[model samples]
Target: MNEKEALILKLIKEDPFISHFDLAAKADLPGDRVAGYISSLMKQGKIVGRAYVLPEQRQVLCVGGANIDRKIWSKGVLELGTSNPAESSKSCGGVARNIAENLGRLGSGVSVLTAVGEDHEGHWLMEYTRAFADVAPSEILKGHSTGTYTAVLDQEGEMTVALAEMSLYDSITPEFIDRKWSYFASSDFIMLDTNFPADVLNRIIERCRKENIQLCITPVSSPKAKKLPHDLLGVTWLIANKDEAEAISGIKIETEGDFFRAAETIIHKGVEKVVISRGDKGLIYFTEKGEAGVLIPPAISIIDVTGAGDSLVAGIIYAHLNRIQTEDACKIGMACSILTLQSIETVNPILNNQQLLETFKQNFK
Candidate 1:
């Protein structure tokens, strides 16, 4: 075998499910070149077995909330404590659900582990979410009420006020996650949002640690963000909004310096990587190994800011799983967020790997 082919084979043997993107990164070669080498190896019968056959099929387990989102768009200027002419719509949403759907749309195999109520909202959520993800009926609760988020948007499509009835997530107890330990242990990556109960989150973190599975976390909200442990042991990636980051790091973010410091505080707590999303201003990220930078997104018209953060998390996870470089991964994340920002829907229906790559090429190149 050629030297490049031999090296690819060694990497495949080490991580049978590693993506060509990851292999290319490790070999410091262009992705297309690596793909050519892999194809040659496969044609020569040097690559075999199910695991090495389809790297894109590697599964990601998303454990957290699944709920219905009710959005109201005002037709005019807002008034306090009074009704106004507005457009109302309901869609399937929740931090974890959005991330999973984005990943699935981007050609990743994704499974959702969350609970929804027996009501119509829950049923609708389950059916809609299943379009992009594998969510077993048993994983959804039968008796409880499905979680719901109600938001009022301004004329600019920015959320002005929001309310959530997410108590149903309590049904996803530690015992429930414990029952699914085997599945968690087998996944290529585990992603979680803070909508889960603190104890349940702790259990999943501990289990991922023991199994050596990569764990990615999003705080979901400033309040629920506090559910994260003070010491973020076992967390491979921690992605949060500015508010959520401040809450977890106990550092107020007012300037670029403060943003880096906040990320540093979280990294010191044992998180391998920290990404703090600063809306409009862009994102600042830091790694435990001292890699840090700010990614400024290309300017784009904003249709709706909802679900942008979820898309960012999904993008980061997608790029990271493919072993893309950290800076480029953040750029991909920015691209995803920009796509969502241009859509009225919480998760843009047209989002996919091809679209993301096109956006990256158009903006970054």
Candidate 2:
């Protein structure tokens, strides 16, 4: 193929549904010239007709930690300083991985960008994340210990304390992101967790801004959340739990007024929208355009709250990609969290688009 034809093919591979106009713009060619090239390629059997084209799947790239989670569920009231009877289990869990899995289950084209060690745990995590998303071979690093998080859950399934060993993620440097930059450029949206190094996050933020890509973030936890940049310019969405919002914004969330103020503080930092997950009380949100409200989720029996926040992020992204209204998007996110809370696993395996819609109708309608 000629140079122009090769360039057109590359662009098409990156985005199968890219319009002729967009292709012309990117290729720096006249519209007629681009059309001629496409027609030529079609005649050569290098490009298929749109009639055979599948619906474009909106791709979301998630960049953050991918680790093994160890949960210790106490059978009864436990002492903090001493041993207690507990049921222990291990599963693949990380803020980014969980979000990717949830989005994959919801039928979004998802990809994960993170690092894992060369150990058994890393191999396991790589395979597990690949089950739900497309993971590039270079995304998983070598010669480091795979990150791990250990959580102690109370009898009510609420987390009491958790410890994370995720230094391996430090290897996800700006250079690493640059190596996989095409994924970011082609994605419909990008989700980041605060587990990333600050410099790496900043680099990604800058790139997304330059490309006009929508960027979303999940502040994994309070302490780690503090690692986020002070200025969140170009951030399309900031999804955080109450503690994470409080930590990042330094606003104590003791009342309804405080919740609004916290969301406002984040919006002032240049985040287009801020969503605060308030566990059982539901969600409170605010937008840069002065729209704000609370979404109270329907009550449900709790099993384990392990990955509720991650699932909530996935739900909102899913809704946004599908062009669901903002208010209804929050409702879908609430339903996702409710479904996750009822499952013992980190991500509810049975959760799908149909089930999420049914839950939303049953509760919100």
Candidate 3:
């Protein structure tokens, strides 16, 4: 997004009903140029529908990756060295992308910032994801294929092996985010994925701190989590799974006591709050006020766990936006996780505010 385009998006976000003439006047651009910018936004999936109707000003900006996920599950006993029959499925998956979709489905105004290829796969991903959240791709490489993750799973729904081809995310550099820095001014919260480069992570962390913007971060994996800068001063929330928490905290989490300690260690590193998701063991959290608690999810059959963590982040962000209590917010997150775990899709299409509340009521309450 260029400076003028970014400006137009901002003006629209502030007032979605603003006329093209008023927008041009406010942006100090020619009427013809303003029209061109709006047209570009529409083509980019940033602006949808006629008369400049877009979801509210992307209150939450999610930055990281958006990619295709292919999963193959063995129907019977696994044979690693030989051919085996398996059922296959594909869906859109990426930490930031999944979370953004989850939020958008739950009626949160959100936007996704990532990089993609300019090929058919990229186009498909953008169009599909745009159905849930506004798409703001940083760069669309002309020749590169979109990033992809292929996983082999056992009949028990556990991942046996996985491979990632996500080099396309490298285009989402610090400089690229710099161009869209204006977007943050109106965003109520910002979420980042660890797929970003180490420098880009620090740049955003520092920028959020300087701007006093509430920031939340979810690590993509243990290795990427380890890339987060130590000075997390501006980070308001850090929601990480067990491996990610351990990687960032340098603590070997074994007993339940370690979860709180790890969260404290992360807080000492400058985060205001930390959540250590322990998978089936539920999660442990620590607030800036020195408060702490652990919540366990109800046992339930799961179909797939591919995007559960991202959905948890989405639920938590939604709760935070609505001023729900921290403990209850965690419950909502767990409920969202439970729902995602039961779905084959990475982002549950049936999820909505009412369903989320119903799920929470049926499980946690």
Stretches of model 3 off by over 4 angstroms after superposition: 1-56
Which one wins on lDDT? 3
RMSD of model 3 against the true structure? 5.9
TM-score of 1: 0.83
Kindly list the per-residue Cα lDDT of model 3 for residues 1-365, writing each as its tens digit. Answer: 78999999989889888998899899998999998998778755467767787734668999898889999999998997899999999888888989999999998988888888898888888889888887863457786789999988888887888898998676566787666675665578999999978888888898889878899999988998988998898798999998999999999999999888899999999998898898888998898888799998998998888888899999999999999878988999999999999988888879998999999999997
Q: What does candidate 2 score on TM?
A: 0.85
lDDT of 2 by residue, 1-365 (tens): 68998898889888888888889999999999998888766544355556224223338989888899999999999787898899999999989989999999998899888888889998898887787898872355667898999999999998999999999887677887775675676578999998888898889888888768899989888888988888888999999988999998999999988999999999989999899988889888899998889988877899999999899999999998889877888889988888899999999999998999998899999
Compute each candidate's TM-score over C-alphas: 0.83, 0.85, 0.85
List of clashing residue pairs for candidate 3:
none
lDDT for model 1, please: 0.86
Q: After superposition, how far is residue 60 of candidate 2 from its true place, in Å?
A: 0.5
Candidate 1: tens digits of C-alpha lDDT, residues 1-365: 78988888889888888886788899889998987887666544455434575223337988888888999999999888998999999899998899999999998989888888888887788888888988862365677888999999999898999999998787677888765664565478989999988988888888788667899999889999998777678799999989999999999888899999999999989899999988998999899999999888888889999999999999999999899988999999989888999998999999998999999899888
